[model samples]
Target: SLSDRLQGTFDKLRGKGRLTEDDINSAMREIRMALLEADVNYRVVKTFVSACKEKCMTSEVLDSLTPAQNVVMIVLDQLTKLLGSTESKLVLAQNRTPNVIMLVGLQGSGKTTAAAKLAYLLKGQGHSPLLAACDTHRPAAADQLQTLGNEISVPVFRGDGKDAVAVARDSIQEAVDHLNDIVIVDTAGRLQVDEEMMQEAVDIKSAVKPDQILMVVDAMTGQDIVNVVREFAERVDFDGVIMSKLDGDARGGGALSVREVTGKPIKFVSMGEKPDSLEVFHPDRMAKRILGMGDVYGIIEQAQKVADEKQVEDAERMLLEGFTMDDYLGQLQQIRKMGGLQKMIGMLPGGERMLQQAGNQADESQLTKVESIIRSMTKEERKKPKKINGQRRKRIAAGSGHTVQDVNQVLKQWDQMNKMMGKMRQMTQVSPKGKKKG
Candidate 1:
């Protein structure tokens, strides 16, 4: 969406060898509009566009990028810096037995959900995380967290009382008792920021003396989120911010403004509702995505998280030899581990454009259908798909609850990938000394 609009602006200046005043003016106007339309805060959009314009005007366009691409690069650079240049990790003290992190935000900002997500992430990193339900005000806040904790297989700590402060204080002992290296305290939230809410947050902070107190802000709120962040920062003095519901189709302009205006790095972003949907916020990757330059590195990181080294080596070997239907299923599984097709597409540069071309086939359900079709096949047919004659194809389609055309589609995709992988393997061949053998 942002990519298409910006590309339209850049297309008119295609013939220009260098960025002239007129070209820069036209480009900046388009960029300004694009950012604003993307729901970026007005102040942030103004500052970002101004910086990109100034840089493009003063500096020579790099020979590597086209005049249009050069200006895009300038914008990308500024946007990256506008969002934080690097990842802000949730640091824990090595000396401490249990690292406490308190999550605070207004109601519906996803504070409770974010807590479980954080625990899921920490648990993945080999830390024993205990979820502390310090949210006594909400009717089912504790239950909601407990459900999430159950889903993630993490322990929940809830003291038998209405006092959130005491519950948080006692969670430390709970953490130590459970041998949890990390304790995530999910605090109560109100419809809006009020004195009572602030006081409760302050009391939790005072009682727990958390290692990090993160303010959770809803990214869809745009500029209004800044006010919430400011209030929480002033009242409770949060250590960092965790913007939630980023997966939703919000302009995400609020995210662009949060760090610059507040002077706090966004440590994490809640991408989806699942416990595993939380992702460590990487500014450069996000900026690249905004510019339609896919995040290859981020995709690789996610892939690595789900795939073992042995599996990677085996996949490469299989690709070089001849990937089978079973191998095809394995590849799909790996992609699924990396957050499915739609998410993967977002990380690729020009991915959204490609998505437009692919049409409805890019949906995650397609992958599921493909997996079902593969599973319906016999082991012999999977190893040698050519054995799957018309009757077998029909059987697979019927078993997978799809038409024969869908099964045919799956087979066609596998064939394409097999051929492509063969080509890649051939092109990558080298001599013993790592030089081209031919």
Candidate 2:
């Protein structure tokens, strides 16, 4: 919603040929309101707005032919600055046999999941990571960590489920014995910040001397995140933050507040429930996404991860030729590999408007039905959807356990998609003079 609000403000600015002081002020006012409504810390919002206003008021922006674009760039810069300016990478101690990474946060802030996610990430990077279940205070916390570890194929070390400090300290030695290069310690958490919880975290830190301490914060914590982070900074002096549940429907105020409040960077974000969903945080890309410019690089990265060279070539060939149902189904599976349609749309510029134009085809829940319908078709029907007559449609609907209307709807959507691809191909074709073909 903050993204939508900000995009709307910029859209108004973009509509104008030039900007006046009044226009800049009006946009600033809207931005201020959007941030506040999104639950950004009042002081952070005030400071951010002031900085953006100062930058936008300059003649470089006011007198520019593309004043709106200039203002958007200025805002993007400031937002990136507010979100920690640069990427904060996880620092593991060099030459250390086993690097220790400690996770701390309030209860339900996703510390255990974050630990597993981080371990999974490290393991992918060729490090042998071991997870330590040090949250003896929480019921089944060790079991949960063990389950996640098993899913990731990483080892989990648990103590007697009585002394968290001992468990954390022993985890390092366990890593040494097994030749694990990194040990991620999942610390205990309280429902709220308290002296006892803080002291226990401090005690564990003293005992293990972790190479990096990541403070896990729920992205939905809103205004209270500032205070929670402040207390953690005062106590554990965390190295960076692991922002969890960023894929939730929260306004994302806590994520914006944490770095500014604690003078720390957000190292990673837990964007999904899967262990592989922990992503390295990039402030510039995030700022662009927030401003509705989209993260093209991020989309490319996701594509690279999911689609191989042949898959890409196949997709290109399908774009040139007509996309058969088989091609469409393969693309849908690739999208699923890249986090589903909703997520792919979220990474695109003006994605909301794009979804609006695409209608039900963009709905993630409809993907299952569409897949089922396509799968129910015979291979010949899939290769030549044009030959699917009334009887064939009825058969497909019955086979896919859907109404005939549903089958027809899927056919209509596929036709529309093919038409759109045709238009795109025509628009992108080069003429002899190197100009785009009409």
Among all candidates shown, the one with the greatest TM-score:
2
**Candidate No. with top lDDT:** 2
* Per-residue lDDT of model 2, residues 267-357, tens digit only: 9989888898899998887787777666645655676677886765565666557699998898788888776687776665556455666
Q: Residues 33-53, candidate 1, lDDT per residue (tens digit)?
A: 987887676888888888888
Total backbone collisions, model 2: 0
Residue 182, candidate 1: alpha-carbon lDDT: 88
Q: After superposition, how far is residue 94 of candidate 1 from its true place, in Å?
A: 2.4
- For model 1 the local lDDT of residue 323 reads 86
Candidate 2 global Cα RMSD: 6.3
TM-score of 1: 0.78
Stretches > 4 Å off in candidate 1: 10-17, 62-65, 307-333, 336-339, 353-365, 368-438
Q: Summing lDDT over every window of 10 consecutive residues in candidate 1, give the lowest-scoring window.
A: 429-438
Candidates in order have lDDT scores of: 0.79, 0.84
